[model samples]
Target: MLSFIVLCAALWVSFHLIAGYVAQRLPLDWLADLPIIGASYGWERGGRCYEWLGIRVWKDHLPEAGGLLRDGFSKRQLASAEPDYLDRFAHETSRAEFGHWLTWALALTFFLWTPWQMGVFMVVYGGLINVPFILIQRYNRARLRRFIARSARRSARAD
Candidate 1:
């Protein structure tokens, strides 16, 4: 049981790391306005939908993995308003969301060695852990995109 547990942990970590690496290399434009990742009606509406989830109360309690890699971008704080920074931050949110989704799918590997009941448990566990992070990324990305658009319109008017 111990070895099986270790294997599960390793698989989860490996999947997330690979997903993060791939996300970093992906073009920002590719993630931008991706219909699949695009904000839904509630998320687009100032991310108010998240308030119902008590997101503000527990979001910070999750382990912060943004800084795990040496060159990884940390989303803990918004340090700058520069276009490039905001753009990259926006891209990072999509990246994080993609990573969670991929990791959740990869959890299926747990079933290969474990029994069916255990597999179901692993999958459920994966969802329980990843869903909140996924929602956070989506909520943040929606807000950030809205802010960027407003800024763009303001600049256009000034010009």
Candidate 2:
């Protein structure tokens, strides 16, 4: 029981820590809105579907776990209006989403260590822990993309 507790804590924290480091250095192209983890057909909605899940209400509560390595800005909110800054922020969203997905997958290691019943619980725990963050990342990324495009259009018009 004690070991399981320690294992879960270590796994969750370590994955994000390592992921934060990796995300900071990842090529922007790798973070582009592609498929699966990237921008999908419905993501253009800017997370409206997540409204029912109270994302706007509770999302602020989530820690900026990667902030230490992610340029020290709050991912929970917009950092800047600079096109370059917004562009980078959007990429961070993808990086964050990728990290949660990776953590969730590797969290399956919980299943291998515990009994079947406990393993099932761990799987559910993993999903519960990671899914919301995944949604938040996708939702934020979608909005960021739109914001970037709109700003660019507005700039073009002005110029």
Q: Give Cα-based local distance difference scores for all models.
A: 0.80, 0.75
- lDDT tens readout by residue for model 1, 57-136: 88788876777776678888799998779878888887788778878888888778878998899899989989999889
Clashing residue pairs found in predicted model 1 = none
Q: What lDDT score goes with residue 127 in model 2?
A: 88
Off by over 4 Å in 2: 70-74
Question: Model 2 TM-score?
Answer: 0.83
Score every model by TM-score: 0.85, 0.83
lDDT of 2 by residue, 1-159 (tens): 899689778877887676667666776568765467766556446667778888888888887776676354458667578988887787777888777777777667766776778767767877898899988887787777878888889999999
Highest lDDT model number: 1
